[model samples]
Target: MSPNLFFQIKILANITELRSLIIVKQLLNSTFLYIGTFS
Candidate 1:
């Protein structure tokens, strides 16, 4: 594959990784909040 195509794929992978991380963080925060409320 070309260098430009490789670079674009790398960027897309990074963005997807970042989005997943944010979603995980949000889920954890909400879970903690829910537990705190119950206890």
Candidate 2:
């Protein structure tokens, strides 16, 4: 495979990872907020 194609794939992977991390963070934050509200 070409280096350019490899680089693009790497970038796409990083973006996907970042999106997953953000989603997880949001879920955790919301969960904490819910617990705090009820506690």
Candidate 3:
């Protein structure tokens, strides 16, 4: 494979990782908020 193609794959992978991190953070925040409200 070409170097350019490898770079593109790396960029996409990084973006996906970042997106998942953001999603997980949001879920954790919501969970804490819910628990706070209940308690």
Candidate 4:
């Protein structure tokens, strides 16, 4: 494989990881809020 292709794939992987982290954080925040409201 070419260096350029590898670099692109690495970047894509990082972006995907970052997006999933953001989503998980949002979900956690919402869950905490719900618990706080009811308890």
Q: How good is model 4 by TM-score?
A: 0.98
Give the distance in Å from residue 29's predicted Cα in candidate 1 to where it truly belongs. 0.2
lDDT of 2: 1.00
Q: Tens digit of lDDT per residue, candidate 3, span 1-37?
A: 9999999999999999999999999999999999999
The C-alpha TM-scores of every prediction are 0.98, 0.95, 0.98, 0.98
lDDT for residue 32 in candidate 1, whole number 0-100 = 100
Clashes of 3: 0
After superposition, candidate 1 runs with Cα above 4 Å error: none
**Candidate 4, residue 35: how far the Cα is off, in Å:** 0.2
Pairs of colliding residues, candidate 3: none
The sequence of per-residue lDDT tens digits that candidate 1 reaches over residues 1-39 is 999999999999999999999999999999999999999
Clashing pairs in 1: none
Task: List ranges where model 3 is wrong by over 4 Å.
Answer: none
Q: What is the lDDT of residue 27 in candidate 3?
A: 100
What lDDT score belongs to each candidate, Candidate 1 first?
Answer: 1.00, 1.00, 1.00, 1.00
Model 3 TM-score relative to the real fold: 0.98
Q: Which 10-residue window of candidate 4 scores lowest in summed lDDT?
A: 1-10
- Candidate 2 per-residue lDDT over residues 1-39, each given as its tens digit: 999999999999999999999999999999999999999
C-alpha lDDT of candidate 1 relative to the true structure? 1.00
The 10-residue segment with the lowest total lDDT in model 2:
1-10
Better-scoring candidate (TM-score), 2 or 4: 4
